[model samples]
Target: MSNKILIVDEDSKIRKVARVYLEKEGYDVLSAENGVRALKEVCESEISLILIDVKIFTMNWIEACLKIRKNNVIPIIFMFNEIENINAVQVLPSVMGDYIKKPFNSEELIEIVKLRIKRYKISPSYQKLDKINIEIGSLTINRDTRQVFIANNTVRLTQKEFDILELLASNKGIVFSIEKIYEKIWGDVFFESDNTVMVHIRKIREKIEEEPENPRYIRTVWGVGYRI
Candidate 1:
């Protein structure tokens, strides 16, 4: 998978901060101080995702985004300081994948970068699941469509929830530590304070388990992690 991220911003500080954190997380980080350089980088290299500031010094940021999206569906995330500025560039959600406010936390920036890159990596046409259908007790997991069904009824799950469940279901009977699960899904370093995975597990159990306290499909190995 291409783990390249192109960061476009006028401020050198922004680029430096992003490059430092992203490279530390194992991404091939590239940066541009202006739109011309940014476009040239995209044309010359395989960029997995883009993080662009809505405000740029050399060119209109919105026009830059439009030009980039003209031929590529690579994920693009907007960065801006003010909420009003974000609203100004409210183009089709299809063109813009996500946004992050400036002065963002290092952890939050890393998390978003990992998520966007991970989603881009798992293209339906390119990536294949180990198993298409996973059955555990009354639960049914459809890997192709990323859906879960229980007793012939659909169990809706958030993207993260589905990811955690799919990971466990496909590799049934193998206990995965919290660090492993977080790294596999988030594509970034895992910290103990990051309860994002834990929360998603709880939510998945609530939707799929008859008793979340004592999950049937997803069994928690005490002080270890979880398994199916």
Candidate 2:
């Protein structure tokens, strides 16, 4: 299943906290403050599921949901507050629920997101890639098999190495910071002293990259991070 989720909420604090939690579970999360930007994200990105606030003050999100339903069929989980009346969502067939109430716990949010993403995949209308593969130059990654091949020769990688590579390869242009990479792969908080991601990147380059010192597939952005 795709590990990309979008959180649509006007509250910056909510978005940040939810982002941190979801990233720990290896999800690449995108956020939008209101319906306009949220609709733009849904159109541009392959968002596996959407966690939208029931009350979007910036714009009418119910209208957004209706618009989304016209084209896409991804899971739409509502984040509602106790005081807000979510009766409008009743007409939305795509709404998984309005169960995520305000003052919600992170665990509940994560659980609901996971369940919806998994459950929605069961639909016959949802298209599944026959072969989940990523190819960059000579490097070919079969995500389903968790295998990497360099010009027909299988390249052996440690589990972490493969995870890092797949993370970068799957999101080609996006540069992930060392901290972000460490958290997503290790599923733990990264300390400043930790060079774990750097070490793993080196090992992956040695195996798949023709020249480890001057890598082709995984390029390091000076002082930023790595990207494919």
Candidate 3:
């Protein structure tokens, strides 16, 4: 299946250019000029990735990214006019998947898209399971139906959250720096703040950990990074 992508930017010229290039690469593209339309498209369509402008029609990309993280795991790449305003290490803990300074090379953008899709394929969380049952302590992850159960109660997780959990679980004892984790999960070796990863981890912990303040599965590595 051709991967579908959603592009959100207020500038029609930018959208047209992006659409042209992406279409030439054989991707089915959808676009929105505002956050409202973007949200609608995301909720109503089967989009694999999203390329969003950081500033779009009264919508803050960070907040939009966070909202998107609440429901979908689709890789989100933020395009900004200035790289200096973004904190690559600190923001990695939030909803940032990748960061592209404006005036991005068309070829580079395509490569990034391909890389993100490739990484998503190998993600432990997105792995298909033959069985419906799997256990993680009191939490049960249902691969067949895409559901997580804790103490017989269901815990809903966004696609990104599940992906992060799967990565950490797949390498239980291995420590992953925020940068490493961002690269692995986001397919972007160059990213914004590390906090983007931290924020997502916190969200995941809130859902699965008995106490997010003192997590059991996902652990912080002080000045380094995180581990499970």
Candidate 4:
């Protein structure tokens, strides 16, 4: 069966919007107006992933996520307004698969959903590329294990972060404009001021560079893009 996605929110409009776009991407979309209905759907359906609002009308999002996670391994993506403590949500009982800030554009939402679901279905062993490793400065990348190291320390990175690092490191010294990088990695047209790629780049630098403000490996080209 095609992967099924559940969108749980009290607002019918949000559910409809999410469902329409998700369905367009060839996913089987299901939605619940409240946590009770959401949990019921989880019990009855083979849900592949869940997109939940932080504030549901009937229950707290973290509570609902914790309840569902007690039994299911389905990936959960939190949808929250900018006002919420987004970073704090990461420490909830169950792992939050991902989060999207409020007022997200359709393309951005879909991209995040696609990447998260892709990671969910693919095993780590299979996600790794064949026998390729790169070493630059203090950074070491092992494509076989999809891991990065700075000196003797292993630097933890999200899939997207690893992908970005791999791209820049593999083609060392090649300047990649933000738009080009987005298109190559995301397989989509880049949009203006989409900070998604930029955010990941910053995070990757913090993990790999000794000093992010004065990055040694990943260098910025001012008005252009980034290179290593």
State the lDDT of candidate 4 residue by residue for 1-228, as single tens digits. Answer: 457789988778888888888888888888998788887777655567889887762336457667766644578888887655565664565656678876677898889888877776674432332235576765678776676767535688999899999999888889999999999889998989798889999998898887899999999999999999
Residue-level lDDT of model 1, residues 101-155, one tens digit each, is 9898789998998888778667652243324657677677767666677854578
For model 4, what is the error of residue 68's alpha carbon versus the real structure, in angstroms, after optimal superposition?
2.8
**For residues 107-190, what per-residue lDDT tens digits would candidate 2 score against the true structure?**
998888888877767765454432366767767787766878776456889999999999999999999999999999999999
Q: Under the 3 Å rule for N, CA and C atoms, how many clashes does model 1 have?
A: 0
Runs in model 1 lying further than 4 Å from the true structure: 57-61, 92-94, 125-228
Any residue pairs clashing in model 4, and if so which? none
Which candidate model has the greater lDDT, 2 or 3?
A: 2
Q: What order do candidates take by lDDT, descending?
A: 2, 1, 4, 3
Per-residue lDDT for 113-144 in model 3, tens only? Answer: 99997886676544542133455566566554
**Candidate 3, overall lDDT?**
0.75
RMSD of each: 17.2, 15.0, 18.1, 18.8
Candidate 4 segments exceeding 4 Å error: 57-64, 85-93, 124-228
TM-score of each: 0.51, 0.54, 0.52, 0.49
Which ten contiguous residues of candidate 1 have the minimum total lDDT? 124-133
